[model samples]
Target: MSQFSLSNDNDDSGRLKIHLNSCYLHVKVTRPYIIITMGDQIYQTSISEYPDGRWNEGFEFSVSYHAQLFDTIQLDVYDSYMILPDRHVGRAEIRLIQLQDMPATFTSFYEVWDKKLSTGASSHAVRKTTMATNVGALQATISYRFLHIGDPQQQQQQLQQHDLDRQPMEDDLIFRKHLQQNRDTADILFHKYEEGSHANMDQLHLGTQGHTESRTTSSSSANTMLGSLGSWFGKGTASTSLGHPTDPTTDDLPTDILNDIDSSLKTYPLLDTLGSWTVSKETNQILRAIGKLLAAFGQGFELSNLQMLSGFAVVERFYQELPREQRTWDVVRDLSEIQVASHLWRYSMASYGWKGLNFIGKGNGYLSDAIRHHSDSKSVMEHLSLPPDDLLAYEFRNSGAFRPSYFVAHDPSTHSIVLSIRGTMVRPKLIAYCNRHSIGALYIVGHSLGAATASLLTIMLLDYMDELQKGQSLPFTLQCFGYAPACCVSLDLAEKYKDHIQSIVFADDVVSKLCYGTMMDLKQMIIAGAEAAQNLGISQFLWTGAAGKEKWKSAFEQVAECRQRCIDSMENPRLYVAGKVYQFWLDPTPKNPTRIVVERTSPKRVSSELILKTSIIMDHLPTNFDIAFRRATESMMTEPREQQDGVLDQEDESRTAEQELKHTSKRGGTDGSPMIDEQYTR
Candidate 1:
C-alpha cells in the first residue's frame, strides 16, 4: 500500500474527506460509479442504484499538505456494461483552492458535461447545446483538514527542509541577474552601432573586440560564482549564455551576404540617396529612412518642414490679396440662420467646455438664461443664440478612454438634434456610438478627430436607417458638418454621401489631405527625389539649409520633378475626405486685394498633392475656422448676387488667367508670388 493510503496512519500530513450525496442524469443507467482522482491517487465509489442514483457514502484519503493545496480533484462518472467498455457519462473537476477558504464543509452542485458531445464544436455551439450535453449534476460535500504530526522540533526540521528546497531557486535568480547585466551591456553597444555615433573605423573595430571580450569575461565570472552552488546541489554547471555560444563578427559574414547588402543599397533609390558615407552612417540612415517609409505606408505620411514652408509660401500669396479691412473682420452681428457654420462653430467650441462649467448643468439654468435674456446672458448661452425654450434635452457621454465623447443637444428652433463631438483628447479610444433618440433632423458637427468620427457615424446611421426607422412615423435625416476632418471613408462613399455631408476644409490644413494613397504618393516622391539627388551626387540635406545655394537649387529641382511625377501617378480606391468639400482659401489676384474664396471641390482634387505649409496645424483649430467662416460669410454677403451665383463657373478661367500672367511675368515676382506654375508646376 502507498503511504497516501487512508489507514489512520499517525504520520499522515493531511486528509481529504468527500461525501458522495446524489447525482441527476439525463440518461438512465443500470450501474453507475464515480472515479475521483487527486495527483496520482485514485478512488472509486461503489456502484449506485438506477433512477435516483443516491449513495450518500463518504470516502477519505491521506494526502500531503502540498498536494492538498495545489492538486485538482476530478470526478468521472461511468456506466458498467459488463461485456462492453465502461461508458463515460460525464466529468467534473474542482481545484483545492476553491475549498481551502471554507470554514467547515463545502457543499455545491457541480454540472457534469458530456466531453464526447462537446468535441470539435465552437464555444458558441457548445453554449447552444449546454442543456443537451449536461449529462447530470453532482451534489457533493468536500472537507479538508491538516493534522499536527509532531512537536516543535520536527516542525523546525521541516522549515529547514523548505529553506533547502528554495536554495536552487535563489541560485537561479542570481544567475539571471548576471545574465541580464550582460544583455544590457550588449544592448547598449548594439544601440550605439544603430545610431551611427561611432567616431571612426578604428574605434568601431576596437569596440566590437572589447564587447566580445567583456561578454566572455562576464560568462566565466558568472559560472565561477555558481560553481560551488552547483556542487552543493549535486547538479551540472548551468548554461551561461542565453543565445549562441559564439558571437558572429563582420569578418565572419559571408561574401554573398555583403554583396546582397550592396546590391540592395543600389537597387533601392532611397537607400542610394544616403550615399556611401561610413558603413555605420549608411546603415543608420538607410534603416531610419526605411522605418519612415514603412510608417508612412501604414499610418499616412507627413511633409518635411522645407516642403511645408514651400507650399505655405505659394498659398500665402493668395491670402495676401485679402483686403486689409476684411483681414481684420470679426463677427460683430448675429447671423440670420441658426444652423449656419458660425453657430456650428460655437456649438463645437461649447462641447469642449462641457465638463468644466456648472451653469450648463443637468437642469440647464444657463439655457433658461439664454431663453430669457437673449443677448444679455453671460456664459456659453451668449455664444449660443438659440430661440426661447428651444433647448430640450442634453447629454454628455465621456466615460472610457478609447470611447469618443460627444455632446447631444435637442434644438427645436430648426427641428433638429445637434451632436457636437469633441476632437481627439489624450489617449482617446476611437469608437462610434450611434442611436436615434428622436425622429427630428440630426445635425452632426465636429472638428479634426471628432469630425472623422461624425463622418463615420453618419455613414453607419445611413446604412442602418431602415432598422432605426422601424416604428417611427417620420424618417430621420442626418447632415454632417466636419471642419478640417481627416479622410475617413473611401472616394466612392464620399461621392455616394455628397448630398448629406459637407466638409469645410481651411486652406492648407494637413489633416484634410491625410489618406493612405496620398501618403503612398508622398513616399514615392521622397524615393524619386532621393534617386535624382543620388544620380547627381548632390546631398539631399542641401535643400533645407544655405550651405550651397547652387547645390540647394539643384536638389530642389529634383524634388520638384519627383513631386510632379507623384502627383500625376495618384490612384483610386483610396480613403477620401467624406462629403461635399468646400475649401476656404485666400485668393490674391495680381494688382487686386486678397479675398477669401470658398470653392466647392472634389475630394480627389483636394487630396491630389499635399499642401505643405507652416499653418497646416493652426488651420485645423476651431478658433481659426470660426474666423475664416465669419470672413467668408462676410465676403459672400458683400459680393453681388450675380457674382455669388457665377463664382464657381468663373473660378477656372480666373485661376488659369492668373497662372498664365504669373508665368509670363518675372520668375521671381516683386509681389512675392514665386511663379509656382512656371517654376514648380503645382
Candidate 2:
C-alpha cells in the first residue's frame, strides 16, 4: 500500500487525480483527450477545447494493491485529430521506487514532446519519417493511495467483530480529524522552534512528542489504528534502497580459474584479441573474450533459421570451419526455440566455451555434419512445471516464460513479448551440462533476442548452482555479455547484475532500444497487421531488386508510404530497452575516418529518437558491429597466426592504442558522436 503525490511546485494543485484498486487502474485527463493505461486497463477523456497551456491545476491518483513490484509506469498524452490519427503529444514515465522518496503528497513536473517528421523528395517522390522532440510542458499535482491488505482472513475477522463496514464511519472520521489536528499542532510547534531561540528547541520537541502520544492514545481503534499508524510512521522505510551495491573490495577470481583461462589462451592465441575489449578492471578481460565467442553462436543462428533445423550438425560444422586459432571453443549443448503453452518461444540451450585443461592441444570434439538429422519429437513443455511455494520467490514469471526459482532484484517487470518459450526448457539442461563438464567459469554472449534469453539463463543458472551447493562457494564463476540485448529483467534485476553483465550497443541500433521499458498489447496487433502489409511491399521490392528489374517499383513506393503513415500514426510501440549499456557511436562527422567514439559510461536517459537515418535494418545486423570495430581500431583483418601450444610470442597492440588516444576526449557527447577514446590494459 502506498500513496503518490504528483505535482509541480510552480503550479496550482488539485487539478489532476489518479487511483488504483486491486488490479484496476484509473486516470483523469484534463485538456485534450488524455488516455492513461497500464496492462489492459485504460481510462481516456473526451476531446476538450482547452488550449495546451490553459490548465494550471493538477490531479490525484490512488491504488489498493502492492505497487512496488512495477518496474515502470508511463502516462501518455495525446491530441485528437478530426480526420487523421491521434497525435502523441508526450509522455511521463516514472519508476515506482523513485516516487516513494518524496513527501506523501508532492508535486513533480513532466516534459511533453511533439512528433516531428523528417521527409525527403527524391526527384519525383516524397518520403516522410516521424520522430519525437521535447516541446510543451504540463504542470499537475497528482497523488495516489494504496490500501494494504495484510492477512485478509484476520482483517475480515476483525471487521466482523467490530460491526464495521469498509467505508469510514462517523467514529473513524472523528478519529482522523483528531489525528490531523494533532499533526498540525506538531508542525506549528516545530516551526516555532525554528523562529525562536535555540534555548526553546528542546521544549518544542517535548511538547510535540507529548501531543503526538495523546492523539495516538485517544484515536486508537484496534481494527484501523495499525494501518493509520503504519502510514504515518512508515514513510520512506518500505521503499527499496536506491542505487547499486558497493563494488567488490577484491576481484571475485580464483587461482585455478585464472590458470584454466590462461591455458585456453595459450592453446588458442586468437583469444588474445580479448585485450582489445576493455572494461574498468583488468581481471574482467577473460569474461569479455568468452562473451564475444558466445555472441558468435547467437550471431550464427541469425545466419539462417535453416541452420537451427540442423541442430547439432550445423553447430559442429560451424565450429569445424573456424580457423584453428578460433576452433578451441566447444558447444556444450545446443538450445532451440520450442513451444510453450500456445506460443513458440526462443529458449534454446546452446552454450559455446572452452572445455578447460583436459582438452588442451586437442581439437574440440565434433559430431559429423553428414549425420542424419533427427528433430526433437517430445513436447518440451510437457515436463516443465512450476516449483513449490518456497522456491517460487526466486523464480521469474512473465507473460512469456517461467522458472521454478531464481535470484531477482525485482518481480512483475516488463519482458519482451517475443521472448521464446525455450527459456522454460533451457535452465535445467544448462545446469546439467555445467555439472557434467566441470566448467570452472561460465560466460554467455547473446545478441538481440538471444541476449534477453542469456540474461534470464544467467540468473536462473546462478540460483540453481547456489541451491545445489547449499550456500558454499561453488567451483565456477558466471558472467554474460549482451550485444544489443533487449530489456529482459526488471530494473532491480538489471541493477543486481550490473557488475556481472556488459550490454554493448551500436549507434542508433533500433532493435536494442525498441522494447526497453514497454509492454506489447492486443491493440498493437492492428499496427502489427499494418506492419505486415508494408512488409509485403518490401518483400516484393526485394524480389524485384534481386532480379535487376524495375518491376514492383510501385510496391517500393507503397512501402515508403506505409512506413510514413505508421510513423505519423504513432503505431509503433516504444518499449524500454534495459541493461547497463555501453554504446559505440559512429563519428557524426567523419573528420578522422579511423576513429569511432566509444562511450565507456552508461547512458543517463534513453533517447526517444527511433527513426533511422540510413538503412533501417542494417543498423541491427551483426556485421555492423564489425564495421564499427574496424573504424574504431583503424586496423585491417589480422593474418592468421601460427599456433604452438605453451609457446607464447605476442606483443600488445600498443601502437593501435596510441593512435586511438590521439583524438580529442569526447565522453558524454551528444547525437551519437565520439564519447571517449578506449584506453585500458590487461
Best by lDDT: 1
- Lowest-scoring 10 consecutive residues by lDDT in candidate 1? 191-200
Task: Tell me the number of clashing residue pairs for each predicted model.
Answer: 5, 40
| Model 1 alpha-carbon drift over 4 Å, by segment | 1-339, 354-382, 385-400, 423-439, 467-475, 527-557, 568-573, 588-594, 642-682
lDDT of 1 by residue, 355-380 (tens): 22322232244333222211121223
lDDT of 1: 0.50
lDDT tens readout by residue for model 2, 1-682:
1233444332222112443211111222334545554322345544555544342332233221223223234455676677777766655445444554455455566554332211110101221233234444455444533222454543444344443454547644544454345434523221111100111112233212421111222323231233322222322111112221221211232344465444333233354455334321224545554553333222211212332222222222222222222111221111110012111111121111111101221112212111111101001111122111101111121111122112111001111111121132232323332333343444544567666666776665555445223322455556555666665654556667765566666655666545422211111222222233333444442354654233333333433444345435442224333445566543322234234433443422332223322332455555445445445433212211232111111223323343444344343432122222332100
Model 2 gets an lDDT of 0.34
- Ten-residue segment with the worst summed lDDT in candidate 2? 369-378
User: Per-model C-alpha lDDT, please?
Assistant: 0.50, 0.34
